[model samples]
Target: MKNLRLERCGITQYDEIFYNLSYDELFRHETDAALPDSERGVVASSGAVAVDTGKFTGRSPKDKYVVNEETSRDKIWWGIGPVAPTTNNSDNQQISEETWYYLKDLCLKRLNGRKLYVVDGFCGTNEDSRMRIRLVTEIAWKAHFFKNMFIRPTAKELEGFVPDWTILDACKITCPEPQRHNLRTPVFVAFNMMERMTLIGGTWYGGEIKKGIFSVMNYFLPLKGMGSFHCSANMGRDGDTALFFGLSGTGKTTLSTDPKRLLIGDDEHGWDHDGIFNLEGGCYAKCIKLSPEKEPDIFKAIRRNALLENVVMDAKGVVDYSCDKKTENTRASYPIDHIERIVRPVSRGGHPSRIIFLTCDAYGVLPPVAKLTQDQAMYHFLSGYTAKVAGTELGITEPKATFSTCFGQAFLFLHPTRYANILGRKMEEHGSQAYLVNTGWIRGKYGEGERMDLASTRRIIDAILDGTLDEASFETMPIFNLQVPREIPGVDSGILNPRNVWKDKADYDKTCRKLAGMFMAHFNNFTDTEKGRALVAAGPQLDAEADAAYSSEA
Candidate 1:
């Protein structure tokens, strides 16, 4: 095998490189070879390799930065509003050309003399639109992770396959001179879109690598007239495709992995003139509390060659999926083919006939399921409404309302309105229906109300896909102006209106008005644009008299 050395880049002083090693080779290297103290190779009960990412188990979104170069400065979204001190503030600083070069040099230097592992793969599954990628990491497990996460090339396809983009993962390297580097922390995850290269250092979290490539796709795919989505998709027996959009904890993965439906892609995808294509070759699913009964496909997918991150296991290698002692962001990375029923070719699928926006509403004010008009769809799409449940992040004990534009704010490159407009146009052209489903609290607030039963949520989703809900009588909800169905097959009629389920109707009304106010307040961030204005008009309306009456009662 020809070792592709980075010495050609004029930075590597050493000549060692392991290029395109097979799964067995990587496993052997990680398990038998003398690895770093930070890297631990543990075998799970299913014979899969499991590793712990110390300190940083989840993504450090604030640390992610995009170089504001001349070619991409105007095209990139530099984030709006005030920067929060504790949040990932990638938009806060636009690194100078000199600084980017300096960081690249540092990353390459860190790789020198280290046993580098390189994995060559493709990003998009569509043969027509696929982009070749080469990832160089300091650890063998990361190489294995990337191999599973990205589309692998066959022997014939791998011959002379030049990468269109490259990622240098120097996870173990940390900058000792933070002041000289002008960094808030010793670690950094920076992307230079102009160079089509990403540099990651000072963190061991593998998600940074996965999402870094996604960020690149989010930027470049739009210029090609493709809509890049942070959503999951699957197709039915009748060739009907459905897209599920939501953030972490919002059932995007679980719902999309329907046993009856053929999985298209989970997490990220790109929609073009033809149809949708999977952006990845694998699934990186949240495995905390994962059980076979709840998600058999995902549960069974964790077999040999799968990589479990931060999952607690006993001395005998039996995994305890319920444990979140390490971190709530426990994950499992496995190849897409691991699942029994998946769309063959895994590249492309027909345009979706139904679009579902999944949200976890802690406030319990939103309806269980609501049919959205075109305008309302665009409005909700931009708002990206959801609640950040406790324990997902540090210091967040109670549910907090969050509005990430396009449902993947951390990975967005262009203005959110751009993606929203594309979606609206596509929905209109294809006559696709949109629905908002809240798989969260019911009757009262987070502490007072119980979660919507997963079985009920599944039934609602089934109805949406089979067109059963289309025949049900609809009623307009107050404050939010949502058109909710009066009845469904499996769900209780009393809970449909939300207010009926609450013992204190006045409290429910007050909560609804409060949520409506929150929506209007968050919408103010985009009111300057014409599309934003239209979306605002489509949102929930608050009544002044009702607000005063509710306030007086309080």
Candidate 2:
């Protein structure tokens, strides 16, 4: 076992200073890191202290312990080193070691009254070591909201913990009273708003998820549409411009901020009285194999305050996004401060010019993008779109499908219907256009990787930005298909049919039947259920007469 042997800080040094227990005894004998003082004891007393391997003397991190894959499976091993960490695939900014200690200092200072510590709680012994350390400091400050931040001690640990829903119901939340304590450091403020107040953290890796940070803790407020979901809505001017929703990889950031179009907000946004206003100060970009060439602007935005997650490291522990062995959300979460329009308190008001939903259809049969009629819009909205996370693909080989309404669930704090209603009402009020764009592979089956030309994708974006597609004559596609005018510039007219993604006509028909079966099955789960039906009823009709007019291979 890799143990912490206190050579300098002696036993009985400050025992029972606050909590009626021996500090030295606790530290020396406890498997748990450091214990917190009970109610009647000392308040948080620790300051920013650097993480060292031992009480004294410098030691080579690699020499202190060995990485034994064959043994020590249950032990946690923190990478002890002296140098400041460089930015990873997910982050472009490197936090200094001094700044790192400030993060611990914040925990020490805030723990006295806090009840939680939001953290990345995935299955990693390395991550757990850090989690334990966070607790040691959390109890010192006793900050009121740090509970549920670390690992659950027992099954019943959740017994009295406030349910996530309760926090959502608490309407007005401001920067905690004295405002956020100015540690003069930028430790990530790990808070969840998707469905409740959750412990959230953003650790830096290689612009990807690394240790213990959760990306899907959106708030749960049902203001409109349907059940709860993660949403990011912000209004720039009249709020009648656009709202982007998609999973991590889909080009929400890329498409929404079309170079020709002005950007309202980048990442987290709250839909308020005026419109959508971004709640964050930065964007968390995924950085697998990221290069200045592929996404120059995003690449350049990383600097100070960005936290990289789960990027493979080099011999020097520097991030290497080129490696795909790590988790899929190899993400870089930086404050929204980088984007110009990010609002304070993250609230805004405005109208939208259009409502655009994005999807990455790996199958590639879908158009680069297609505008929708009212009915068609609702149908596509409910169907949603998903592609497997880069490394998360199953060995089963077939690309798995995940359906989520209004794609950006990682930040939405309301039911899906709530967002849908606001969007629908606003679209009607301002005569906004609704469209769906597919940013995945094209001209090949899901795994073949014979991709759609990015040049064509650019052209499609150009058409959307310039309003060329708005005038195209879109016919209602028959048999559960959205009306796609036969020949649209920037997209191949021939591949509009679902059957195009498959090679043999027989295989095409089988997949279509299977997909249709899934649709029917999911649809059956709802009988007059919430706004889901309203969305369906309001969408394009599956015309019985049109079913026979066109071939499945049309």
Among the numbered candidates, top TM-score falls to 1
Estimate the TM-score for candidate 2.
Answer: 0.57
lDDT of 2 by residue, 1-554 (tens): 11212111111122212221222322222223444312112111111111111111111111111122222212211222213331210111222334333432333333323332222121111211111211111222121111212222233432323222111111011123111332212224322222122111221111112111222222212222212223344443333356666675677766665444445455444443344444322455666787767766556554433334445554444555687564544555443444444334333335545566777766444555677766556555555665653454445556556665455322232334445565565567667677777777655557764555667666765665456778777655444456565556756766544444455655544444444444444444222346667656544334455445445435
The sequence of per-residue lDDT tens digits that candidate 1 reaches over residues 73-184 is: 8887774322334232224345667777888888888887777788999999877777889898878889999999999999888887887888989887776776566666
Instruction: List per-candidate RMSD values in Å.
Output: 2.9, 17.0
lDDT for 198 (candidate 1): 85
Instruction: Candidate 1: list runs displaced more than 4 Å.
Output: 3-11, 80-93, 389-398, 545-554
lDDT of 2 at 195: 18
Question: How many times do residue backbones clash in model 2?
Answer: 101
lDDT computed for candidate 1: 0.84
**What TM-score would you give candidate 1 relative to the actual structure?**
0.94
